[model samples]
Target: MSEILARLAAVEEENRQLRQEVEALRRDHADHRETVGREIASDRRRITALETPAPALREKTAEDHVNRLFSEMRRLNIRQTTAKDAARLLGVSKPLIDKLKPYLATDPRFLILRDPHHKQRHLIRLAGT
Candidate 1:
């Protein structure tokens, strides 16, 4: 009877230890899951940032095009040009010339004028010339 009771006590102690081990494993699993979730969220944010296009790059490219257009006009000694002629000189579409009108209008180096002979035509010229 004494031997049987000792054996039973040993079994109970082993069961308690197993339960503690299982609880520790659960806690470790929870921590691992939390860490993985945070990493996934961070990756998503990085992806979103990468996917968004940069507007500054487009604006810089447009500014370069405008500068090139001005250089070409100066090289050709063109004091003034119609939108169609400017588009042809710049090797760009007429709609692009229309888009550039705002930039030309705002710049102190350039002037925009309405054609007296043709109401539909606008003349772009170097300022003060």
Candidate 2:
């Protein structure tokens, strides 16, 4: 009878140890799940940031185009050119040059003249020249 009681006590002790191990395993599993979930959320945030588009570029203003035209004319040593030629040199539409005509006429840095060779054409020149 005493031997049977001893065996029963040993079995009970092993069962208690197994329960402790199972509880430890459950805690470790919860921690692992929490870590994985956090990593997934971080990865999703990174993906969202990467997918967002950049802001649109700023459009060039008329003054900016005019400055570029003037710079090109000076660099090429052009004293005078017709509106059509100026538009071609500046890589802009003729209508844009037409829009700038009034401003160029009033500007102190430029001269507007009638082309002697072409009755229908106007010439643009630097003010000093």
Candidate 3:
């Protein structure tokens, strides 16, 4: 009976130690979660701060740049201009001028034409001019 009691006491002590370890683990988990949350919130704040100054720092909006391009197109004496010419004249990337196709389609003052002799070449021209 004394031996059984001693074994029971040892088991109880082991259980107590296990409970303490479990509690410590819980605390460590909570601390880790709190740290991660703080880091995520800090990242969100940093992203917002980086984004806030962009508009005021921009040289011009897309609309303003496109309007400037139209004005320049109007001032040209030539009846028609190629994409390369327009890109050179506007001092903008060819892809940027290419993006204007949908806008040009809707505008009354301009037309897009394909060259039959030189396949795949496109021209921009003043309508009825």
Give the winner by TM-score. 1
Error of 2 at 10 (Å): 99
Pick by lDDT: 2 or 3, better one: 2
Per-residue CA lDDT of candidate 3, range 1-129, in tens?
999999999999999999999999999999999999999999999999988853331224445655666678777676778877877887887776676666666677778899666798888887878
Ten-residue stretch with the least lDDT total in model 3: 53-62
TM-score of each: 0.53, 0.51, 0.50
User: Model 2: which ten-residue window has the lowest total lDDT?
Assistant: 54-63
Candidate number that wins on lDDT, 1 or 2: 1
lDDT tens digits, residue span 1-129, model 1 = 999999999999999999999999999999999999999999999999999964343566567767877888899999988999999997888977887888888877789999888989999998868
Model 2, span 17-117: residue lDDT tens: 99999999999999999999999999999999999975432234656766777788899989888899999998888877877777678777678899999
Model with the higher TM-score, candidate 2 or 3: 2
Count of clashing residue pairs in every prediction? 0, 0, 0
The superposed Cα distance between candidate 3 and the true structure at residue 72, in angstroms, equals: 3.5
Q: lDDT per prediction?
A: 0.87, 0.84, 0.77
Model 2 scores a TM of 0.51
